[model samples]
Target: MALRAHVGKLRVHQAASEVAVESVSLARRFRGPGAAERGDQLVRAALSVTSNIAEACGRGSVAEFRQFLLYARGSAQEALSQLDIARRLEPPMLTTVIRRLESRSALVIKQLGRLHDNPPRQR
Candidate 1:
């Protein structure tokens, strides 16, 4: 739960910062472009991944956490899909950002799976 909460906060912080930086420029250049909606969708999807995990952790049940991890994993895939779309409409600079986020999301999913399979001892 602590790990998920911490990672969720990180994801939110990173995603918010990334959007804050690119949103203004993207809005100007792609105002009338389809990428506008896509960009927003991608950011929200990334947020959903972490948010759901955090919410689930608060439930204080291994089953609930596992379910939420599934949601988080799904959200990660959704974000990745939106990223692929965003790349076509945006600049190459976003490449590193997307890659880093993708890696983190993957790692989080793996960690969640490990937790589900082998829960830690409680004090």
Candidate 2:
């Protein structure tokens, strides 16, 4: 089906950008009047994760890339905290979406750890 194909494309994602897109969508669902502030914070943190990943991978050295990945991982953690705060206001579908994004965040963090622990050999 179409939904499955779209999800397959997401699985081919790079630089954590796909997860950022999901977070932005999740943020939009919080447009109810009082939710703007928390939503803004969440969006910023989520966007930072994507940008950091891109910046990290662009760095000249493995050490530099690892540093940026640490920053991305930190932003991901902040996003998770914000999600916890906003969970009370959201309906269950939004909660499910946030959970998926959170899982992606965890994957990014774990992959970053692996890269740091066993960096790619440069000839």
Candidate 3:
């Protein structure tokens, strides 16, 4: 099967993709001291979440997929931490965006956990 078709079947992949997009949007909005560096970290972590999920889908077995899901979950956590740090350091104007990203990251983590706990049977 095609890579996109395979990945499209997983709900976790969709959630992770949304988180990545939101992270990029949030990072673009960042400004002020240290904003650039923090934004870079946030974007990288967020992207990693989805990238790992995609890697999971491409793997040969359920165990391999679950392993990658763990990586994705860790990246999600990293992104969430970055969001929290950004919320503390950034101006009040960015609170809403940061909160939204945090919520999305949490969802991705939850979805990853579900997949990791009970991975689909390998075809």
Error of model 2, residue 93, in angstroms: 3.9
lDDT of 2 by residue, 31-78 (tens): 566788888888898888777766665666767766876887788788
Q: Lowest summed-lDDT stretch of 10 residues in model 1? A: 1-10
What tens-digit string does per-residue lDDT give for candidate 1 at 1-123?
332334344444354345334433443443336766876776677667657766665656566666876786677677667656665666776666655655655565566566556543332
Supply the global lDDT for candidate 3: 0.85
The local lDDT score (0 to 100) that residue 37 gets in candidate 3 is 96
Query: What is the alpha-carbon lDDT of model 2 when measured against the actual structure?
Result: 0.69
lDDT of each: 0.58, 0.69, 0.85
The residue-by-residue lDDT of candidate 3 on 5-92, one tens digit each, is: 2678888888888888888888888888888999999999999988998898888777778888899899999999999999998889
Best by lDDT: 3
Candidate 1 wrong stretches, greater than 4 Å:
1-32, 120-123
- RMSDs, each prediction? 5.0, 8.1, 2.7
By summed lDDT, the worst window of 10 consecutive residues in model 3 runs over 1-10
